[model samples]
Target: MVDVLEAGGWGLLAGSALLLGAVLGYTLRIPHQVVASVMAFGAGVLLSAVSFELALEAYDRSGMLPLVLGTVAGAAAYTAGNVLLARRGARHRKRSGQVRGRSQPSEGQQAGSGLALALGALLDGVPESAVIGLGTAEGGAVSAVTVAAVFISNVPEGLSSSAGMRGAGRGKGYVFGLWGSIAAASMVAAAVGSAVAGALPASAVAAVTAVAAGAILTMVADTMIPEAFEEAHQAVGLIVVAGFLVSFALSRA
Candidate 1:
């Protein structure tokens, strides 16, 4: 119970950033370039965390087979889901509705886009939070690198997605409610991940961690990097490298 609570606490702490970003997006007039830079930085953070913290740890725990299979499976799953969501009008979920060069969806598309956006957020967030629980299942301290990466990355995701929802004519109620629910779900995912991992064998735990790493890697490539490059362009590369170095330092520390 203590472990579960601890994991949930950490999960909530990270997930809270989404709500913060949502509020900022709705209330502020932040520039696209700034959002893009931050998004790129966050993506780099996540990349480093996935490589050194999650995937490396998983490799050290079990052998190559579990790590490779799990990663491939995770990436495949996320790709399939993303394709479905895209077909349903959530392809620009990470955009500000105007940043991607695509026109705003018509009224008919707006009605269903909100639901797709909510689901897309869930698909992106749940696996990341689950790994937090995996980190604590051994009764050790949760990985600070993973927690920080998730929190930092989620801020831009929430901000950009909320901005897109707003531009799509979504109401404040729907936008906030969607993020709030997803945050709550993140807490639950972390707790459940901890509980489940505690009962699994070491190989299984490693596979699960690898799975999360793969999903996160795919997400960063598919959604985040493109959006960042859309606005920040050449500067995003430097910002990403800086973010990666910071996360790598945290992992070492």
Candidate 2:
């Protein structure tokens, strides 16, 4: 139990690095195009990591059914969660009479965006934290790799999250709220990881890989890439590719 707590604490601390990034993003005065490029690059790296490292390795270590099923399960879980949130968000907007008309974002729209970002993080964090906790419990070379991959993938995610908040024009309160919620998700993940240690170790890694990949891909293609183009000219595409390569290198390292 003590070990589990310690692992959870570590996982939460690591996840909180994301929040720190959000605060730093406030100071950096990041351009929208830059954010897009970074997000795209990060997405590429995440995709590569999930495909080459997490998914492939898990299958190698375990077998076909567990790997495939786990991957599908992870994707399904993410889809279901997002679908539910979309419905809820729509309803929330409808109730408040807020989401009507053009998407130019009226004054309070930012608040909605902040809430949306927080909601997304909360949904994503559980499995992530769980993976970290399980890695720590394993306590060996494998643990090191798992922790490192998760840590790497998390950096861009944190920064991108903050970027989302800023883009939405969320105030400091919302910024902190989003960050706090994401941190809490890390803790949730840790709890889930602890619980799954014995029951479904092998499948968990594969599932997480798939889910993270899908989410990251959607975010880059849909949100970040578009934001980048909106902020600057087409020249930024090169920069975006460079960022992707940099992240890929780090992931490999």
lDDT of 2 by residue, 1-253 (tens): 7657766776677677667767766556654445556555545555555556556765775777766666666666666665665554411221112222525444344345445545666666666566566655554223444444455445545554555456556687767766867786787678666656767656556555455545544545544455456544465567555655655565567
For model 2, which pairs clash? 129-189, 129-190, 130-189
lDDT by candidate, in order shown: 0.83, 0.56
TM-score of decoy 2:
0.70
Put down candidate 1 lDDT per residue, 46-118, tens digits, no spaces. Answer: 8999999888988999989999988998899888988887788765444434545677566545535556656
Q: What is the lDDT, from 0 to 100, of the residue 91 in candidate 1?
A: 57
TM-score of 1: 0.92
Q: Residue 24 error for model 1, in Å?
A: 1.3
Can you tell me which runs of candidate 1 are displaced by over 4 Å? 93-115
lDDT of 2: 0.56
List clash counts for every candidate, in order.
0, 3
Q: What are the runs in model 2 whose C-alpha is more than 4 Å off?
A: 1-6, 25-28, 83-103, 139-174, 191-195, 199-253
